[model samples]
Every structure is written in C-alpha cells, then in structure tokens.
Target: MFPKHVRTHHRLHHGHKPEELDFLIRRESVSGGATSSQMQREFGRLNEEEKENLLKGVGLRPGIPSGAGLLLKANLALSWNKLRHLRRWLRNWNVSLDSESKDREKAKGMTSPLVAEQLPFTFTVKGPDGKLATEVRLASCVCLEDISSTVLQRLDLLEREGKLTWHGVIPSDEIWLKIGGDKGGGSTKAVFELCNVAHPNSIENTIVWNIFQAPDRRHNIETAYKINLSQINALCGTMWK
Candidate 1:
C-alpha cells in the first residue's frame, strides 16, 4: 500500500479515482516487492506521464502491466520511435541520392551511357542470433529469386571464412531479402529504386541491403518477398541492437 503523501501525489498529478489508484498501488507493490525508499527512487525516475500511468494503471484492474512489463514496453516504444526517425532520414537520403544520380547521368550525356541496368546495393546479412554475419556490395537488376541467390552466395563465402555458421543447411529458398521495412512483400522496381538511392555513386556500387533467413517451414518461405526501403531501414533500426 502507498503512503498518504503518495496517494496525495497520485490524486494531484493523475486525478485517478481513489479506489482505482489504491488497487494499482497495491498491485504494483506486490509485483515489485520494493521497499518504500526504493519505490521513491523508482518513482522519481519516471517522467510526468509515466508517473500518471503508474498510478492510474494499465490494462484491466488486476491485470496491470508489471514494472518489468512496463520497462519492456518502454524499450520497445523507444526502439520504434527511433525506427520512425530513421525512416525519415532514409527517405531524405533517397531523394538526395536520386538528385545526384540524375545530375551525373546528364553530365555523362550519350557518350558514356550505362551499359547494363545494374542496381548496386549494400547487403547486410544477419545470423540466427541477430548478429551481423556479413555485409557486402552487390549489383544486379534482377528478380527477388536472383537477389536471394546472390545473398546466399555471399553467406556461403562468409561461412567458409568462419564469419558465419549455421545449424543446418540454410536452403536458398529460405534466404530472402526484407526490403525496406516490410516482411511480406516487395517488388523489383522498389528494390531498384532503393539500390539507386542508397548507391548513387555508381549503379554498380553497393546500396543498403538486409538479408534474413526464414524458418525452415515451407509456409514461411512461400510468404517471404521483397520489402520497401523505408521498411528495411525501420527493421534495421529496430533489430541492429
């Protein structure tokens, strides 16, 4: 149970009903098992909104999120917020890259026309433990299948170099690109644009790429497809840590 001053603080700041606030304080007290001094220290760390939520509670009456759960949720929210910011940054980067590419193309004129439609992008492959396995530059203007193949080839090389190791065979079909930030679907044109934006120096230079290995299940592979660049950036922002 909370002290009189704590109750007054809740009433003053949160305006929660007395009975409701009492219930939440009791629940949190049981879940946290903190001394009064510890509680004060923890409470002091919370911002105004968090302090209000702590008193008012979350979810149902008895099912309020525990301190640990609240901490996890806060971390997740922070990560998502960072991801959103990264998405904005990537969008700006893409626009800048496009402008530069156009200027270079105009400068070259008809004398040095690009021979092949090469889409160079940076590839970042993560192992099963959510660690970076390898990162490389690849140039290809092809379908998703071809892109997956190229990524797999790089993974194979890394595995041989002892940079990456797998539990069992990571089938080529199980290897896929999580383009942009989406997990379900992506297209060649989107990949081309993303690569072009991320690799403005040369269409043959590397652009941002994310390689993920799906579960061994057939359904997972079937559902996997290319995703948008913003989505990829968002995913990277979240998963990189």
Candidate 2:
C-alpha cells in the first residue's frame, strides 16, 4: 500500500502536512543525494512505508530513473525553468513561436501590422508514453478550414514511419494534435519534463529542433538553435546510453 494518503493535487499546492513533513525527512536519508549524515539518523524515526512514499513523491525509485537519468531529468527541469523566464525577453524581441491569435487582436487595437505570420503550423506529436517519437508537423499547411484533413493525413504519415511514431489517433494511445494553448510557462515546463522522461534520449534536441524547424520564428530566437544540425543530431545518438 502507498504510505501517504495525500492526493497528488493537494500535495502539489500545499505540500505535505506537518505530520507528513517527517516522511520527507526520513526518505531523504536512504537516497544517495542526502547531504548530511544527520539525515541517515533521522530516517530511523519513521516507518518504512513513509520513507518510500516520500521518495516516490520526488520521483526517486531504488533503481528506476537510474542515477544518470535522475541527474539528467533534474538538469533538464532546470534548463526548462530558465527557458520559461526568457519569454519576457522573447516577447520584447518579437519571438512568436507560440500561438499568435492573442497577439493579433492586440496588434489590431494599436494599428500595428500583424508581425506574426500564418504558415504551415508545426507541433510535436506526443505519445501515450508521453515521449515524442519523431518531430513531425502537418505534412502541409493548416488553417482552420483544412485543419481536420491535414491532421488526418499527417497522422497517417506518422504511422507509416512506424519504427518510432504511431497513429490512429487514439486519445489514450496515440493522437494527432497541435499544441493547443499556453498553460502558463511553469505548466509548460512541467509538461516538457514529463515528455522528456517519456521520450528520454535526445529529448532536449528534439525540443530545440522543433523550435528551430518552425517556419516563422521572427523574434527572440534562442541562440542555442544556431548550432549545426549535425552537431545537434549527435546528441540524439547518445541519448539512451
């Protein structure tokens, strides 16, 4: 049985209750990252299950994430956080890689030309495993009128590619869809980390590629994207090892 009864939704916002804080202190002991020997002593005070629950909450398993995987995920989470902060700078510099409809109306009010463009809309195809198979976009341009058809065809192509990608558009298993809306920068980064875990290797590269490969990136280009594709490609090769 799971040790802690706290539902994830509550824990996320409120953190463990006072009684539960002890669980965190205990779990940190057995795990290798603990900084102090005092933590090891503290673990003796808690029941075993409480210790397990705390570790699980932080995504630590005895061997599952692997030491390297945990470190990579931690670093990736940090990088993603940094990326979110750049949005203000990106907005100032005119980067419009995200959905632009909101900006269009604002621009219309000020009589500014719609600085963003409508082009072949590209988005990542996320899988149930929550990892990305391949970076794919609508095989052709998509506008509201033809979006349905383009989405269908694109999924079909993705399925044919087969080795990594999948389709049939199951909500639970597979699907063809565009990134719908911004759910705040922090939310987006959290989702990105889940996808990275789901997809693992070359996870960072795939994300960078998606942004770089987009048709209309006008402002706030991340300088990281300027590195050669071949160099980026090399990272993918080493993802799993």
Over 1-241, each residue of candidate 1 has an lDDT whose tens digit, in order, gives 4544344345433767779766657745554534466668768999987875665564322222223322332345434345445435544433111233342354454121122333434445897999986443434432233433344454455456654322254443232233332233332222222121222233332222333332222332223333323334443333210
lDDT (Cα, tens digit) per residue for candidate 2, span 1-241: 3234333324443667766665654444334334256566766677978886666677653432213322333356545344445434544433323323433344344231111223333345688899975443332221222223333443344346552333333334433222221223221110111121224244331221122224332221222123222433343343221
The Cα error of candidate 2 at residue 70, in Å, is 4.5
Question: Which regions of candidate 2 are displaced past 4 Å?
Answer: 1-66, 69-76, 80-174, 180-208, 212-241
- Report the lDDT of model 2 for residue 234: 45
Indicate the TM-score of model 1. Answer: 0.17
